[model samples]
Target chain A: MRQTREFANPPVVLGYATIAGPKEGEGPLAAYFDKVINNLYYYEDTWEKAEQKMFLEVAEMALQKASVKKEEVDFFLAGDLLNQIISANFAAKSLGIPFFGLYNACATFYEGLILGAMLIAGGFAKKVLVGVSSHYATVERQYRNPTEQGVQKTPTSQWTVTGAAAVVLGDGEGKIKIPRVTVGKALDYDMFDPSDMGGAMVPAAFDTLLVHFKETGLVYDYYDLMLTGDLARFGQQILVKLLQENNINFGQRLNDCGIMIYRPEQQVNAGGSGTACSALVTAGYVFNELSQGKIHKFLGIGTGALLSQVTTQQGMAIPVIAHAVAFESY
Target chain B: MAIDKNEYQKTVEKIKPRPPVLKNCVLAFLMGGFVCFLGEVLFHFLRGYGLSEKDSYTVVSVVFILISAVLTGTGIYDDLVRIFGAGLIVPITGFANSMVSPALEHKQEGLVLGVGAKLFTVAGPVVIYGILSSLIVAIILRGLGKL
Candidate 1:
């Protein structure tokens, strides 16, 4: 129906937990994260295994925070950037919950959230766990070059966040509630350069945002914050221009998770990316703000550049997507 | 949405973030030069330790390669390259990085199939061409000598 869905009964955010690596832990939102592992390996032999461990940890942490047992959770909705989403699969295996693995690249967190919220709102499940994880080393090797390769990074390249975040969605009342969700269509603006993912995904972010506003009949300033998943500096600039062209300006309320994750001097280049970028930011920063009544209403738009090595190698344009969820403080 | 190629290109050109050429170049120069300087220091050190000039040069090259591989394993070489840009690549350390990086990356696939198979992904062409060109030059020299 090319429209946003407003749930009759909005799902409540029972609890959320964020765990990050050393670099992200050192960033601005370090205090917001629940657990920050200084070691990248995190007692695991490989980076992939470490990411898997993080997913499991965050999921368990979220469940514990919500006072829900693993058996009480109806389904685990999770995703990651790795091939076959091995991290999520392994974590799901350990959690012993019915699993629905998703792949929306960087926007996977929101994808999980929307689906989980729907399950709860539709009365299909009492509780659903939404989780996402991405490791810097793992994503670096899978998406681009290995860390040891020492390949010179383009200034436009965004650093993949080595972190994981999980949220427990329930049918009960809570401090924060997800009222509506806007699912975006896959749009390709003929962006080919993978190194410039922010540039590639900005148009999709704008498109979904515009549609969300139109379908929901919500003004640009309706929410206290309009957060894009991982647009970084360059994508944020492009998004502002795109919004301006449409005669809608979010002004100071607009901030990207990518740009917010790291400081300017951190040398993260364009800033943080991966599924965990927005996941951790929302779970830690935004969730806290909403709980404290600092932000009454907020919109989190997760943007993803659906590019694989195979698609890029085949000379296909990068397909981008953005999904937004409206969260309000109860 | 599909846009015309020319229109898409124009938008990309207008929006794409420009790379900082001057800063990157300076970093590259300093880093690359620093690596070369370290190599020079190693050469002199080897010579001081009683090695001949030629032997010292060889020893320095080997040492630089070993140091680069070790640094890559510890995950320090990548950071150096990140800051130095092309500077680190111009040194002998870059070659070591190119060889070891792929091997380490593919290590998850196991030793033989992963590391052994993909070991030369980057350095393979260089090694093959090097041996081929040297062989060709030697044959040409022999032919000229006969003549």
Candidate 2:
């Protein structure tokens, strides 16, 4: 196994697609998404089923954009925040692709990208598709109270992003390349509050980012942008402070997908989260920048707080992880 | 890894968003008072319509609970709760919402097992204690020759 942090044969990003629900579509980066369903249900009976439909749709859309047939793709690495990752499972079943379902909560998109890039980099697969999705209603019901419960959320509580995004990595020529990935370790700082996920996840994000910078020997200014998955406003603040303490700063360039995806007046508490948070932002906004030659190099770090309702109720600390994937526009 | 517990807690406290307790309390109080006022209006209206005082109170409570349940079903009560905070919850309407919301959410599992079984997941203890307390009060009243 190639245990190195940087990939020798960086995989090329052949094509990518992102789809979001109405709320996300209303966000500032809505125009970047390939498809934005006006309704959360999107013609499905249940929110879970709708999310599954979105996953399948975005997967197909990504493959179509790449001009690759479903059979041409060797593997589909996908995940979602749902229990048992049923959305990805059902989508995989419908797509009839060899599936590897992952669970890193909101950081699932980067996890999928890391694994998919590795599969392509190691010559295990010529073409691999990475997909991730999260529906606000589905995740809200699963993690917290029911949507209809009328439970008042705290200011720190983030809105779960409702969307799906997919990226196809292949050996062929592409506009962008993923050269390195830094997988994060699970770090639990004894933060037991499930509501303040951004606070819980900052330490893990800092640890992974520190490791990435050390391994790559790259400075903060090397990349034009350093993006975290779903740290939102509070997580971004904590991350900045943590990095400053370590004497590594990426001022102004260190933005978060959670804070970028939504408008301030959208009232999304601490901005957006869910697997779709980074997925949509990266595949839509970041990919658009890379394609438009606006950004030369970028580091996308996906952060996730691996906490469940049961774990939280049992008084267990929330363990957080962050995986970083380096991309360059060529 | 050996994380400094004190340092971690300090960082968390520094960065974590503090809940606006005063604002929440004010909103909760106003909303809770409004709900009660609405109940009072209904109670008076019922009593004026020839219903006994006890019957009018019961009718008012039933109407509020019904409204709350419907609001919960239509996904409007949650919006109200978001703005009102504990205001909607402290009232009997909040109790009604609590009962109906979980049942509605679990309705996909089928009627008997999903809705019926998990119906009282939140309100079950309240019902049991409510009945027990009421029974004990009744017994005490009878023993004191006040029943």
Candidate 3:
């Protein structure tokens, strides 16, 4: 909340796990997920339960992959798009780890990582588990409509990715290290229509990108890749135009996790969204890219719409935020 | 840099992708007409059973409503609505689906507060306005001695 932070001792990304539903598993990043569950239900009776199960599954997988016992993990920082963040809290209940349930809509990914990295870098915790999950059906039931309701999505609308992703940030010999974080202020540009979150969130992303560059003296090409989550198809175009107007060009190095998570023909109108959208891509796709040396430095930006069904109905402008975390390979 | 909200909205509107309105309209028209055609055929079949014209009309509507309810229960009505656009909407199927969908979805919250109450969440407005306007028209017609 104060300013952009640069960790004197960067926290290592020890291990990560991604659990995807059938739709996300069928995505282009299918192979990267540790577990691509073919069922949306994830063997649970309800979509909400399924999301909680997916959250816990990813947390357990990440802890195991980090080669650390569940008892060794100090804190669980997680959240989702659900009301009151029940998915993260219920999963945390089963995890038995101290938890902080965040509510940044989709930006919980970056917020969690920012705080988790701080906890590790500031010597507050040795191993902090940062995770987030979201489900299409659960989100629909909560924010939009009934899951099975046949209301067709408009072209600008983004589909919520049904998945969960977790990364264990700890002091360890891991390949990826978190070096800096630029926190986003909740910004709104009077953009209405909750369906067009991409439009509403462009300003937040623009501000964070501007501030991050200003704070770190990092130019557009400083990182090998920069990603904004939930900007989707239409959103990135708007962002690109805005950046060009500001005389900032990221070239082809910039991409969005929303676009990476799904193929064009996947019926995802404006690519993918939800809290899991970015985390799944970062933990699963981008993680592989980093480990494979395809990209050395990656800046992952979490862009979120902070609109509830009630607020949206009450004729309020959709407030949005974007947080950036700079990850580099040691 | 501080943002000019108006300028940002213009940028968003410029790049925003619009829904395929013409295509949706075409599909809706064709499918909507097809559903009515089926109803007409059902009417003829019911009329052939020696039922009165009024009874035949009622039976045809009931048949369509029942089919919609069953499809909604099987979780197939919404899929049809997606492809058909407003095709299913103009007919009674959309109403039936709207009623059934919320009830089924909220059943987990239990019957009283969930299913029973939310049964008409979508259709409630339709019923309220539909009857209210109808009653107003009836009163006007009665005053004019038309009914």
Candidate 4:
């Protein structure tokens, strides 16, 4: 069965904004960020509150940038790395918009995009706001260790992006149009290591990309860019090799958000991972390029490792998923 | 999936870069030695102040604990661990850090349930297992009735 939904009328990306942490702000894509918090606390008492604040602010920023208001948005869809998605839930509480909390791990941002677009195209809603955020301190304390703990990180581990990204999608003309969404399925290759998120997530990315290609009957060159969410450098290498073995050459078109966000010297080990990694890149860099007609058709895939602290602690294998949203510019 | 878990794991293992074992060992050795050396220096310094031998050891330990707590609070201990690896982890300072960091992290949760309960989140296991193993060893020595 085809996994992609071809929209009769595409939902346009009306406005988008990105708020990144200080570390991400110092990275190469710093210019694309809408705001960068100078400190990890972001002036909040706790890291959790800091994340919630970012989520709320980024959603508001997207609306303000689009010349839209909270009342005008038909639905708000959001998620994050926090437990019970407190970031999105608290943000929604303040946003006061009709909300749908979604979770697909790091792929949550694309899931939001997909659902928002679907709502718009299906006449369920005229305008939808989608957002996702992740904080390094919040995730580290929950998933790994205390932020101040002296545990050493493995080389394959990724740094979580301490930021948030939100987009305003409307039915009318927008900067870019999302025409299709290929929702991915959770797949596990018995990847159990929580540290090597790229290892756990690569299969899902590979599976989704292949499904999108086969279901849509489109080749790799059909899009100007086929971006993977946050596979980092190692996962990217393995993915490139896997694609080659399958006789599908992505050439130079395959780019990973994790690898693009930070330089190797940033000491992030592998690279950036987390929901915000892909969201920030797509909402800021890719959206800008699409809006400017730099590349007409683009396929952005958000890859996620759907593993939790409980699952990791219990020695459970990581199941991963990737969702792809294809955008076209007139 | 085209590849099973084992095959995929092999692919990952092949692509994943190996951490520098030798370099890490050398660094860990130097750092761990430095930490121990500091402890010894503090012990001698305390003894020179006319503190009892037992009191000097106690003072050295307390001083190290204080330093580690300060470092962890200032957010420098984790970075030092990244470079030094087990050097920071195998000492009393590490124990102090493990305790202090969790307390600091959970301070927002309030005193009783948050800081007090979570203060031993990391070190709790160490204390439990440490005592268990030591008890086992002591029992074996008693069974031997010597040494």
Candidate 5:
């Protein structure tokens, strides 16, 4: 090892992620809605609160696993899909730690972690906590009408997840080391559709990931897993087809976080969106595997669509951005 | 699974739109009114903090801006907007709230280049028109020697 003071030998992933709502097969929320005359009137409302709760719970879980108290953490960095970070604010109020709230729409998970690692590596802080939260209801209310009920989702629509995930970082913990980060340029197709955020963001994702590969002189085969947040089957197909056209084959390692989160039996017409979709899956599924040392290198990419209701109302097109962070167990 | 003509017509008849329910109207009124009440309460609290009415309004504006900026930066505002829908945004505060957020969001792109220039994104048109109208009004008043 070069120096314990500089970097952890293995860069251990000490923490995990969590979700508040029951899995589709478990039937908790759907059952509650069924009891209310098969109406899901409060799903959004309930999901919003539960989403924040899960973020905090997940953060606590990770902190506990790392054996670090809330006070010992140097900074709390997080983001969400809400206009004013309601979940993060409430969570921070309870955690009572210094925090820097960030937003990159859906891409915030990677953005938060990358910034957290940067702060740690730069000696701004020894131990940094990075996390993000998302809810289904909170998103619909912001982008659509409040009083409208039971609007059928389009095939392109991705179901939002009510969850959050946090990861703790320090000087040397013998876990995964965050190696590199690539920032993407924002690309707006002027297409106002919100149901297909992945389509809007694919260009940015391709651009950034390709640029990272080129600049670092790395090949697509170098990373074992390359993932994108919220892009479901259709979007993933699009990403794959596009990359293949570009002669950049990501192989089977390329996957979408949204597609992985949904169970086939759930009848989720498309897949999942929302900040939590990426956060929890990465925390629960991806991090779980990472901790087991099954995967050594991963490139986590998050996509965010920059669409405000006012912009849509004013007939402005939705622009999207994507960011990526590379990770490896040293 | 082709349907008979008569059955298709009957199904279409059954799918006819119904009138708005009294309960829906009542729920909308109560929820919308409650949000207004909260706004008024916040305004009054700010007023009680020893500021003039105009100053309080400005303070409210600043508070709303900072709140949205911080929330947008932290990724919380998106959740609030998602759940509350227009319930939180349709009020007067929504306009200014939307304006400052994107500015703060792109601050890292370049504070001088991004934040300063893009801060007026949502409110830019309103501010420009407001100044133009005020200038026209002032010119009219001066021509009439009413200053």
Candidate 6:
């Protein structure tokens, strides 16, 4: 038997990471570990440095938990939502580990994990870490206008998640396993509704879910949970309806991390978007739940839309796509 | 590929020099001012249409963007932006200009995948955050008895 468990060497995901805007009340450096991270790191000369410092802090947290030196790790996999992956690239440069740059818009976490787990499972490396970071100001300027002033948005817009996160993956003691990974099928709606990306991703989510069910020869109840990335209230309901319409009732088990992470009414209209939205939730909430044996098998779905005004100016419409991965606790 | 200096010089000489004192400057200033004044008037007019001042500004931005996008597509706004830089960029016009430029720049990508998709590139994050955070913050306040 393959010893079907929750995760193969279920890397007990320890350590949480984040970098918040002024609205997050305090900077990441001001967290409880300020003395170790140093608040002055925020006073660095450039935003790029600031973001890299944030990632390093998160990575160090995972390293501390693992009780392993940075050099002991075989490779480092990181990414961000910048044009050149500056933070991740720089973090890799500073950390002096082999690097892999990733960009899936906000779906970077799942993508990073999928790659990281593959590397470890294929015996390419023993221990590895995967993470993604995004800042509101950095991503906003790249995708939109500068934040020197407030701008208006359409109903389809999604709030960007203002944080960074890192998680450790290893066959350490008391850890879980990560054996089977069913890469998700992508659904691109081309809806052009930035505010409502969840709606755009619904078709893809359903497609991936149904395909997973079909291929695995598993029914709706096969997994204990199904989670979607950043599909706040509006998108969540639309996804539920779409799935139910296809006779795949997700039931209460289908929880959206974007909707669930932040408390209600902070004005994350539809919910948060960014690579960290799902990554952090996966680390903080899902990992906790899975480790506690509260849930064995789960599905994670991340969605992103493929459209920008520059593309639109060329007479293009939005084509939204969603990628979903299924995980089982061994 | 080396440049032909003589041909380039001839081309440069063929280009007519712009007026030392801008005639278009005065016209752009007057027209841009008139448009902005109309926006203020429309702001109040929209209030009469059952919109709050905030809502009116929102409507104004949308209208301004629509008109500006059309004008930009026709290459008129670029002229206006050059002539009356700050004048055109103020209030709703400036906002509209910001919204349209990115779309125009990226229009070469295609409709479903490019133009339609990226219309929000400049404005998408704001709308996304505005809508999402509004809900999240509202819920938080309600939970805390602040709302």
Q: Pick the candidate with the highest lDDT.
A: 4
Candidate 5 Cα misplacement greater than 4 A, ranges: A1-12, A23-47, A146-148, B1-147
Model 4 C-alpha lDDT per residue in residues A44-144, reported as the tens digit of each score: 78889899999999999999999998999999999998889889999999999999998998999999999999999999998999999999999988888
Error of 5 at A172 (Å): 1.1
| B75-99: candidate 5 lDDT, tens digit per residue | 5655554445454455544565566
Candidate RMSDs in order:
2.9, 2.2, 1.5, 1.4, 15.6, 19.5
Worst 10 residues of 4 chain A by lDDT: A212-221
Models 1 onward score TM values of 0.91, 0.95, 0.97, 0.97, 0.63, 0.63
Ranking by TM-score: 4, 3, 2, 1, 6, 5
Q: How far is candidate 3 from the true structure (C-alpha RMSD, Å)?
A: 1.5
Chain A TM-scores of each predicted structure, in the order given, are 0.99, 0.98, 0.98, 0.98, 0.87, 0.84
Better of 1 and 6 by lDDT: 1
Native contact fraction, candidates in order: 0.70, 0.81, 0.62, 0.91, 0.00, 0.00
Model 6 DockQ class? incorrect
Candidate 2 lDDT over A1-330, as tens digits, reads 122266677899999999998999899998999999998889988888899999999999999998999999999999999889999999899988888999999999999999998898888999999999999999988888878887877788899999999999997678899988988888888888888898888888887877887777786689999899898999899888877776767888999999999998999999899999999999999999999999989999999999999999999999999999999986
Tell me the TM-score of model 3.
0.97
Per-residue accuracy of model 3 over A36-148 as CA lDDT, tens digit each: 88888878787888899999989999999988888999999999998889999999999999989898999999999999999998899999999999998889888988865
Q: Scored by CA lDDT, what does every candidate get?
A: 0.90, 0.89, 0.89, 0.92, 0.66, 0.63
Per-candidate DockQ versus the true complex? 0.54, 0.70, 0.69, 0.83, 0.02, 0.02
Off by over 4 Å in 2: A1-4, B1-3, B132-147
iRMSD for each candidate structure, in the order shown: 2.3, 1.7, 1.4, 1.0, 13.9, 20.7
Candidate 6 lDDT tens digits, B33-68: 888788888899999989998999888778877887
The DockQ for candidate 1, computed on C-alphas, is 0.54
